[model samples]
Target: MVRKANEDSLRAQAPVFLVADGMGGHARGDAASQTVVRVFEEHIESGAPSTPERILDAIHSSNDAVRDLSTAGDVGTAVSGTTLAGIAFVDAGADSGCQWMVFNVGDSRVYSWEGDRLHQVTVDHSAVQEMVDAGLLDPQHAESHPERNVITRAIGADEYVDADVWLLPAAKHQAFLICSDGLTKELDDDQIARLLASHTGEDGPSTADVLVEAALGNGGHDNVSVVVVRAMIS
Candidate 1:
């Protein structure tokens, strides 16, 4: 409830489900994240599965667009950056069949949810995450660490983007959760799982809506963005 502006943006329609949490405070974050959505919308056509190359191209193009939003000050350049996480269905090849491409940059996340279980598919590109990986800090304490918000990488923070990606076979049943750090900071994995596992009927509020509400209720210290995608391949 403390934010002056919502710096989070998302594109949750079919074919592309992504959440981008913009950096650079209220002044520039909203534009940075929205730029990502707009660029992707332009690059990837609607109502069809895209190729891996197309998705990758869109990401790189998004980085360039976000970078263009930056401004140079007398002291230094004020860089615009955002955390991006998304899932898309891609045509692998004649032999490889189709697959789900999950990609992430910075601390936003993509999770695979199946059988009422939650699994993190993308690793964070943040200072605390590196500390946790190097055994310098406990995973449990990483979130509350003073440097938890210091991201090591972002879409436009550097000239070259290093996105973490994973490919999963398109199966008969699949569910995914894409969210910004706002939700995770207020709600842990257990809370998120319980909410996602709860059977919200067609008439009820969506799981994504419920999760965002839960975060707002908890503290709402930041902008929250959530996208829940369920695919049935037959």
Candidate 2:
């Protein structure tokens, strides 16, 4: 099972298997995250697969909801936005696979782990990430960058947002990890790779719980949320 704050606002569609992370000032963050989750939940509850297109639409809807909430002045001095990542089971040709779709507005991340390798599947929409992309800064320097926490795109920050989406074929027993920056900011890919390799077995959770626990053990300074899923053949 994925873990987050007791008061955390989160949504998950088990059939679709997705997670969203929200960021905003004060309680507004909670509200934004909750709103996105609620939107997805409504669709899934209605027996929708919550396709990639539907996921994108839900994100836009959540963005509108946040904007509306901000305009209504209910949150009061709080700007709201969130990051979203999800997977939908799919069957293409003779192969049964899963489609991985991610929509992130901030620094939260999605990763895929297979064997001893860990791969980051989502790019952060943050200042530090921009710098790294432009070659203005090395990834090694990102951890201590003073502007590491400054994000360039987010929900409710503006009227328009662009999300990166990808379709990946899931392999049997491969693990998918979705988490907030609170966790990845402190843990490196190699560390994550090691944990995934070490804890995977018959008795394991078959997800990324060990990774989340490692981050918390190092001191969970910010809100930490994680969802781990492993693909299996029936």
Candidate 3:
């Protein structure tokens, strides 16, 4: 529900949500993340519906805002950028109909828990992931690799950036999680799974609260941000 000042800015509205994790030296990092959140909020306030094209446009607008800041010397940094991940809900036109559209850039992640399985919905845009994809490194070795934190893409780093988007059907009792690499770097997938499972029942801690606690408890070496969405039939 809330992101640390050290973390990126986060925005959520019911079923539609987004998280952006920033990286840069000086205050540029904070500027980039805040700019993204502001752009997203503006679009939502103007009543923009959850659509792929609309979301993409919003991201582009955010990138431009950051670039403008850099050009205006407001950020005072040569390079500043952020990773983004978000989900939008869609109506399936039936009594129990709903679906989700997921999008991401850089290393921010989205996870879906359905049945008894946990699935990673976003692909990381880091050097380690690239190496794994190229068969130069095993997937299991990516975590501890020296270049694990080296990201290949970010919102304002380049003139343009590509985002990965996917359409998925909604599932009963399913949960969606979006988080920055800070949490993942410290906690393994298994540990996250266990936490999600344990918090599934009654009045438990919100996902954001639980994840923050986990990261702080683990080390809190970096900023941590988490957004969780639970699906329910209307």
Candidate 4:
């Protein structure tokens, strides 16, 4: 846990919530994450119609900021980087219910909590994840893998970054979670699911606090952040 300064950034709006986890041990990580969040906030606050393309554009702008900041003098040495993950509302055309536009970069994640179960919605862009996908690593063992923290894609790592995006129909009685790898490192999917289910119907902020507490109890090896949002028909 970073006391004096934190590298995690959160942005919340109805149907639009994001979590950016700055890479640890990197220079200007906090600034990198802040830049990412600021770009999204500006887009949202601009009063422009929200669309999937606009969200993607905002992420590109964020990437530009992170890339620029990472190469600035003292901050360039370590190369600042951060994981971006979140959901945005997407209109599904006339007479169709809205859908969720989910995107992710690096190891931070987005999860769907439905039917009393937790389903990871975003694929992690990390070395360990690649190993798991290739059948070279066991999911259980991957947790402690030396390359677990080696993210393959990050917001500020290069000139361009592509995020994995998914669109899912909006559904009631479902909850969405956006969190940093810190939370996942301390709690497995089952544990997180159980904890979230136990707090069903509770407010998002309360559940978020519980999650942070759980991570801390399990040895918070890194900065932890969580955002819990329940889907509802407005």
Query: Which numbered prediction scores highest in TM-score against the true structure?
Result: 1
lDDT of 4 by residue, 118-231 (tens): 899999999999999999999989989999889999998877888899988877656899999889999999899888978754555588888889998988888898998876
Predicted structure 2: lDDT: 0.66
Better of 1 and 3 by lDDT: 1
TM-score, prediction 1: 0.96
Using lDDT, rank the candidates from best to worst: 1, 4, 3, 2
**TM agreement with the true structure for every prediction:** 0.96, 0.82, 0.87, 0.91
Return the clash pairs for model 1, or none: none
Stretches of model 4 off by over 4 angstroms after superposition:
1-4, 46-49, 72-77, 95-97, 201-205
Better of 2 and 3 by TM-score: 3
Query: How would you encode candidate 3's per-residue C-alpha lDDT over 80-171 as one tens digit per residue?
Result: 78888888775535553556889888898999976467799999998999999999999889988998878887888767777788888766
Look at candidate 3 and give me any clashing residue pairs: none
70-100 per-residue lDDT for model 1 (tens digits): 7664112357888899999999889977899
Displacement of the residue 143 alpha carbon in candidate 2, Å: 1.4
Rank all candidate structures by their TM-score, best first, as comma-separated numbers.
1, 4, 3, 2
Better of 1 and 2 by TM-score: 1
lDDT (tens digit, per residue) of candidate 2 on 32-93: 77777776666554433345556677667767876665644544336666666555553333
Q: How many backbone clashes does candidate 4 have?
A: 0
Q: Deviation in angstroms for 165 in model 1?
A: 1.0
